[model samples]
Target: MKGFLEDANYSIGLLDEGATLADIIDNCIYEHTHTGKRAFYVGDLGKLVKKNTQWQNVMAPIKPFYPVKCNSTPGVLEILGTLGIGFACSNKSEMVLVQDLGISPENIIYTSPCKQASQIKYAAKTGINIMTCDSDIELKKIARSHPNAKLLLHIATEDITADEEMNMKFGTTLKNCRHLMECAKEFGIQIVGVKFHISSTCKDLQTYIHAISDARCVFDMAEEFGFKMNILDIGGGFTGSELQLEEVNHVIRPLLDVYFPKESGVNVIAEPGCYYVSSAFTLAVNIIAKKTECDKLLPSGVEQARDDEPVFTYYINDGVYGSFASKLSEKLNTTPEVHKKYKEDEPLFTSSLWGPSCDELDQIVENCLLPELSVGDWLIFANMGSGTLGEQSTFNDYQRPLIYYMMSFSDWDEMQDAGIASDTLMKNFFFVPSCIQLGSEDRFSTAA
Candidate 1:
């Protein structure tokens, strides 16, 4: 029951030796662009699969529950489902999306702390008993609607200094954790675990140590109340950097072993959103227009301009309102790389990139050096899989980008060999008539 990309197509090919991601993007754009929309490589999902495998290896006994709100692309979700990872949904629609993918209700956690009465009722109706709450009012709502629910009290971490402070909006403080747990107890609710997010893009691993310590305190309290705390939901704030994750693991692994030991029967899980999908997607943008600003001088000795500095302003098809919404929402700065290979002597210049919108706030990059590019040339940004497409808007009549899923022919073979790919997935692997289709006819034998 997985969803498929309706208008999209795929091809099998051996990527050229030493071909960079830029090369792959150039080929896709050259072959696929009709009206100049963005392209997404579904093959990138393989990278995520690898990451999940690595996460499992590094932190065994700690399962990963991908946050659907990060990148709800059906293809991404389908791939994760095939990999046997669970999902962390925020709303009823997201829950329905995961359920439609044939994932069981047990594999999904409604992670949103503040829920509407209707959403709570929907979760109850769908038999999604696992949910999170941070406040007393939410506890009351859950008690009235789904007292049978397994609750995870989200504890707020202190002095969070990350790029995005999730605690500012959600999570209860350590002092308030007891009251919420007490309220849940009063309502005869099942408090099964504790949860906390240090913050999104957290740089300080110390916050994780503190938060886990706080969760341990809550576990002790729950035990005192005769409740068997069996789940420790460490909410996600991971950026997909191996070194960073390793550093985090260095701290978390020991903590889990000590606080929630294997013999303790605690099921540890995480709601990772960006970590799984961010590095899997690349965004290719077409430069639609360009303008050069030269210093202008005025009359008399006032000297309006002293030096003639050249600055190029390039307008791209995708902007803040489109696929680059992360620029505004997450304060994410994407470094743009030109698609063409430049010679050693090729000149570079300081330039700014803008989106296709008329709004002044549609700027993407402000004062960066890039190889001189033309209106038709393509510029790509990597690690754009998360926090971008899901929040895109169609403002100013600019259509959203068309995502192109890609996979190396070898990886496709592996997926088929592993029996992880569905019949629908295999059937949808075809070349667009107008685009370049690689491999021999036998390679596309199932395309018909």
Candidate 2:
């Protein structure tokens, strides 16, 4: 137990051996039942420490620079910062956040694809020199705003991805690499290395093989222009799976050793956004309204057979306009596990989850199977910290959810062992329950 912590971003609960995520959730739900039910996110900062260790073990030589766009939660940033992880920021605000955390400018890279000129100038003012550029226009933009900027030329990947629409080429083609290099030389911009963009959703491991090979070609081309390139950033495609990590490492490790060997002095790094924080967060949304329809037409206008099966529609406190914002871009197959206890033999009904906005497009989970739910019952969605709650604009002002950060004492000890200053974390937070509101001066409890 310690003094209370009050932060706009979140209040963390340092869990002891007996406390569990389940205990915290139950306590949060119990408090909300007496007060008002609201949607909130529970982040396990311990998971981040484990993920960092996993990255070190599997992708050792290749350093990880976490992309801020994945999830910019304050707690995430704080823990990652303390773990000695570098950052890959996309915009000014992200830079400001990392800067606020006292991260050095050299440890940050501005990787925004379409960077605003103002942001470039801001980076220059702040002494952040590394940024990525793909085209002549972007190169010029960077050259004009940040004359001393160290650049990583972004190149298009040859491998196709699952979403054909997102597959539209972004980075400059390899053939055009010389042209960009020429431009960089003319502008006197320092080309430090090449960057290959790969999304985490792409399961194909061949993408890494091809992308790394292409990057080697880029490195050789840069040499022709007298540019001493050293960094090869295989941009963020990590899915947080240990199996996938090993698979990717197996494919690229040999290639890296052969192409940009240890003697080459080329620093290889990666942008792992979701890999560190995805599984660390859980979102809990309360059922605000419920509707039961028997043999009625669903949203697809498909009429169900008169099999006497019931369909349920549940309206939750948060929706597309809030915590489930990522639903707009990708299909979320997250089926929530009900928090309330139920009979094993209970009949499960066809169900759909909707957000509070009531906008037709605000549907969170299109269809799921669950036992009949009441208005006050809570549903838990796991692995939610991967960018669902990013960009504050989408949230309805009244419905914005708060975050509760938690980590087991053993994990905290491990983080301290991993070189993070334990005293640095002391002032950030003390201890408190997730949903309970305590005065700043109140003595905080480690109870889950």
Question: Candidate 2: what lDDT?
Answer: 0.82
Query: What Cα-based lDDT does every candidate model obtain?
Result: 0.74, 0.82
- C-alpha TM-score for every candidate: 0.87, 0.91
**Candidate 1 structure, TM-score to reference:** 0.87
Q: What is the C-alpha RMSD of each candidate to the true structure, in Å?
A: 4.5, 4.4
1-448 per-residue lDDT for model 2 (tens digits): 2111124345467766766788777766665676678777778888999998899999997888999988887788888898888999999989998999899998999998899999999999999999998999999999999999999999998666557566456798999899998998899999999999777667778888889889999999888999998899998878899998999899999999999999999999999988998899888889989887853446566766677688899999988877777788877746699999999999998899998876898998878889998998999999888877467544456466657778878787787676684565655555543334333232233333
lDDT of 2 at 153: 91
Model 2 TM-score is: 0.91
As for candidate 1, its clashing pairs are: 42-405, 42-406, 43-406
lDDT of 1 at 21: 46
Give, for candidate 2, the lowest lDDT window spanning 10 residues.
1-10
Worst 10 residues of 1 by lDDT: 439-448
RMSD of candidate 2 to the truth, in angstroms, is 4.4
